[model samples]
Target: MKYLFNLPDFPDSSFVMQITFWTGKQILFKNDALVEQSGEKGKPFLIPDGNGKVVKAYPKPSLPDFAPILIINGEKHRIVAKLPWYQLVLALLPLLLLYGGALGGGAGAIAAMLNMQVFRNEDSAAVKYFKVIGITVAAFAVYFLLVTAIYSVIA
Candidate 1:
């Protein structure tokens, strides 16, 4: 059976991240948190009320915080700084282009939002901008299709 999840704020989003089964029941996980519970499975291993799935199902593997980065672009450019995810992305912006060129960060931003929920948020400025760009592109595609159809009919 199909199930639906409802979240506030991002009201238009369900964002069913990952689904995993335990024993026979189905659990819906989102943002590393189990948001929905279903099925009939008696307690076997853990707590009596624990439908088998814990709050943290798949724990993020601990990653070694240290790793040397070697960059070769005629001159050796070594990035020896430790930074967080956002910081790393920002820091690596300039280095995104390997061959010395404009690394189209705008395109990168749009492409990265390939995920439906984040990309479709009308409230987000980035999402709105991307939607405008997408609509413009779609308009062109439709126009071309119509023109082609008309040409075919005329010819």
Candidate 2:
């Protein structure tokens, strides 16, 4: 997802933001360009400016009512836009539907929706589709077995 904000205080300073995922993947985006990235999963690292100063990037801070904050050039800029929770729910809806006994085309459709939301930009089209199919099938099998076991016990 992309975030846009107006930094009125520091209008001339170029900004870079680094997002460190839970898997320790760091994606660095400076303005519109990706400056650096790491695919290896481990501890998160700091994003350093060209002059060797570390830019502070926080995913979530304790400061109430503040979004993700980026400290660049000693100024804090709040990221105004964020991925909506409903979008996240939409992405995970397929797995939830599978648990609720929806299968077949319904599951596939939901999985497609999820793939569009979650993997569209990150992975190639073929890989995204393959992951969607795998996830949908796995979800269906697990949920079907769970339902069958429950039915067997009740019957």
- Across 61-155, the per-residue lDDT of candidate 2 in tens digits comes to 42321235555445655665444554344345454563364544455444644443444346776776567567756656756776788889999
Report how far off residue 56 is in candidate 1 (Å): 60
Clashing pairs in 1: none
lDDT per residue (tens digit) for residues 21-108 in model 1: 1222334434345554323342111111235533222212122211222211222222222445753343233222223222333333
TM-scores of the models, in the order given: 0.23, 0.36
Overall local distance difference test of candidate 2: 0.49
Worst 10 residues of 1 by lDDT: 59-68
Model 2 has how many clashing residue pairs? Answer: 0
